[model samples]
Target: MQLRFTTDNADAAVLDVEVKELVIAGWVGRDRAAVLHHIRELEALGVPAPGAVPLFYRVATNQLSQQIRLEVVGEETSGEAEPFVFFHRGEYWVSLISDHTDRHLETFSVALSKQACIKPVAGHAWRLSEVKAHWDRLELRAWIKTNGDWITYQQGALSALLTPMDLLNRYFTDRQVEEGFAMSCGTLSAIGGIRPSSEFGMALHDPLLNRTLEHTYITGSLPVIA
Candidate 1:
């Protein structure tokens, strides 16, 4: 799929990028206790525990979108705010993306559930090299609309999860991420527990640079027939 991105440089040129591989990295919390807590949280909803930590799930590249609206099969779905990394022109660029998923399908297969919904990504990105020194200081926040009001959904620092390089190294041992490959790093725990929402908003903030990458999307549920 071809994606348009704006770099953080002074010129801020909009470049067209072609991506072929898409991956979703899960169970990537830096704290073992927190990771287990998340596992239990999902288990309570009938989702099975992952077989391993930082499991990588390959998804279809066509599921990626930059649209502000998404339509899914049912209401049992939610979004996760995460930092997305992609290799382009010999460099890795960082952006914000939501791992929107179907909760109902997740109970049976997490991978399939992820494939059930479209992934929303921001149009702007920052070169990893520009923020590598202060990567841990980056903050991720998400909000969900409930009862006509937007409320905090998730929020945390990048420090809470493994670094991008660490994730790439674990998934692709002995070599760097291949060109045109993109992955969404793990996410933080939901502020008020995971739940479905019609409107979702997410942002990645760089305190040092005083800049943020954000995207919001509205979801419409398609009727389910027996």
Candidate 2:
């Protein structure tokens, strides 16, 4: 899907984003508490500040429905060791905190000058959408990594990566997904004309995809926000 950002002036920007494919440890076999404890334990061992915790956002074709926190506190070097958690926690997802400041020198900007949200659609399987209505009938699915790879389940979703301008442009431009709503998992779009939240952007954050990108990397790729 695409990365969108909303500005204070009620505008939006579309930024280039990416998601990384990783299988988290202990995803297939862990309860909710265990998962949380795992993060705590990692914190005890020191994995990183924000690195251990990933904020998740629910994405759709056009709107962001809700959000959750995916705490990543386990070991980053662990493999398949039952007790050893995976690198990709199924319960954990991440999104960038938006500031809307200028930091890039190359990229386009769109104005999402309206109030909107992000959502995904469901037909034969699951697909990301830009319309809020599409999410009305769809159920959330999660593919936590209790052990092996990401196990898709009917629980929740994970977010791809995004940047500050990315969040603004989406809200400013009012872009939408074009194709591949069936075979593919999700797509990206931009919207506009609405101000972002004080700290974050929307009311919720989470998603369903296999890619992620750092905010700095994404910002650099853009044409520089002003």
lDDT of each: 0.92, 0.22
User: Which regions of candidate 2 deviate over 4 angstroms?
Assistant: 1-130, 156-226
Q: Model 1: which ten-residue window has the lowest total lDDT? A: 7-16
Clash list (residue pairs), candidate 1? none
- In TM-score terms, candidate 1 sits at 0.96
Looking at candidate 2, the ten consecutive residues that score lowest on lDDT are: 77-86
User: What is candidate 2's lDDT per residue for 1-226, written digit by digit as tens?
Assistant: 3333221222222222222221111112114355465446544543221222222222233331113321112122111100000011121112322212111110111011111112221101111222222332222222223343443222322222222223323322565322221111221111221111212211122232322221210111212233
In order of appearance, the predictions have TM-scores of: 0.96, 0.18
Model 2, residue 52: distance off in Å is 27
lDDT of 2 at 44: 55
- After superposition, candidate 1 runs with Cα above 4 Å error: 10-12
**Against the true structure, candidate 1 has what lDDT?**
0.92
Clashes counted in candidate 1 amount to 0
